[model samples]
Target: MSGEFHLSVVIPNRNRAHSLARAVLSVRDDDAGAEIIVVDDCSDEDLSAEYSQLQAMGVRVLQQDSRRRGGAARNRGVREAGGTHVSFLDSDDVWLPGRHDRIRRFYAAPGRDRTVLVSGALLHIDGDIRRPHQPDWRPGRSLVEYCYRDGGRVQTSMLSLPAGIARAHPFDEDLRVNQDTDLAMRMDRAGIAFHIDPEPGVTKEESPRPDRLTTGAETADLSFAWYRRESGDWSPAARSGYFLQDRVWRLADSGRRPAAFAALARSLVPPVSPRETARRALSMIAGEGLYSRLRAGWRQRAPAPADPGLIAAGERWRDLDARARAFCATARDAAAGQPGTIQ
Candidate 1:
């Protein structure tokens, strides 16, 4: 912590000219001596014209030989980077002001020991997260079955790792979706330590953007090498069920009600009666508002991590005053008027 601390900010982008400009500007505005690396993932047309201003500001831009996607682009950036620590920022998201300075102070904090990757809170721009929920979960030394838990995301934009750790476990370029989760799982398997601070690190512009990589369903076109991995106390089927439930919600939320029901029927997770599934499907297709409420009612079950360290790590977020309370209240309101089996 005493020596000069430098961070390499790697942004993997394609066809997000306007968002890319904003992302780059956000980093430049930090002025914390961060090295910015922009990896152009071979957009259909070159973006040199759109990004020349960034280049002029000492932002290093690298282009993939072809369309290898974000994971590959980020790997290239990490290889070319010179800082002791590296962070990934998607082209569309932005870092808030003072983020770089905070990272410096965080590393210098008392009891900050060992080489640990840091994961910060996400600011979702859309509906509340549901499914196997873990609202207050934070990373610990042991492997966490995160994919199943709701509110248990560690987004790529909110991650910063030692350059060595990042290099030792690079992103699997073949993945198009869930790459962030994949990396997190792999890191745990390799015994990498993580420090999660639930302070907003990235402001996500979440919308039903079919064009975005995260929402594009590109994984449908790719294979899952870690599809049913079992670590910690998670069973293979249990792990798969988490993603299975995810697909059901994805289909329902995307307005494919019938597909949602169909997928649910085929899932290994115990299925509700087709009549009940159809009822839910109709509600989803007919009423986005009701869909959210129904999901919110179900999400009242999100588990909070019982570990003291993990819980303490997120105290700053839980005690974020009115904003935090308001967010929690909103979630509660969504469950209003619903029959709570207290299940």
Candidate 2:
């Protein structure tokens, strides 16, 4: 890669000093000529020791004036970065091996410009890295399909673009969740060409952290409204259909069949009847695992989610079916006692 397109890697850190080292090391581990910048988001405890070690290792560290959260930290990093091309690394996640080499070659292609945003795929690393996760569809010359129709997709580590775009369309500092998605939509609106790669770009580390907003955390009403507004340009039918589809997914993933069925009973957006919509929703959820009877029937964490159980098991042995039914019923009752709405 030429010096003209040097990469600046920005990692926003809070309380994850333990993981911050590995995140920084990942960038330094690669031979890519990228500057590493760490923006601290006012962590509660002092991480000065950790920060100092990184600084000695040639990683630059910047402190935020206040605890402005991930989005603000990232925006600040962009302001401080030295390279023309900027990329992000969440403090808790690490770059996969060979990422720098793969990406450098990709962007070094002739005619690749400041206007092109190249995004790659991710492999989930809980204990291993076999299970990969990518967006359902790739973005194209047009923004309509990516933003409005494809149900808003993008991740922080999967992206790399020009610093000018990052500065011009900074992450919405006010938004606690979906800030990346919000910024992606803004970049799309600003006419940045979106490019996607199928290769696993990063290895995401998923640990249950208390400081982090846990699952089901709701977005602020205004942020929610603005994000919805961004997609408001979609045709009414397309917008509503996506909305319904999203709700159905949440309910089914949580093993909330009653809510899922109730959501299905609502009117279809258009060109589809309620019954047909319900049938489709059921089929989709059933593929998640048609244990015992319903999604309501099984409340266990998906046995092997990466495979996604899209195909049915050949036969349902009577003994196995009975055991599944009893297990699911017990699990559902236990979950019912827990309070809080599924987002």
TM-score of each: 0.70, 0.68
TM-score of 1: 0.70
Candidate 1 backbone overlaps, count: 2
Model 2 segments more than 4 A misplaced: 1-3, 125-144, 206-211, 214-217, 220-223, 236-343
- Model 1 — which ten-residue stretch has the worst lDDT? 125-134
Best by lDDT: 1
Model 1 residue 235 lDDT score: 53
Name the weakest run of 10 consecutive residues (lDDT summed) in model 2: 308-317
- What C-alpha lDDT, on a 0 to 100 scale, does residue 217 get in candidate 2? 24
Best by TM-score: 1
lDDT of 1 by residue, 47-126 (tens): 54555545555778887878998889999999999987888898766675567877777766655534444445444335
Candidate 1 clash pair list = 132-150, 133-150
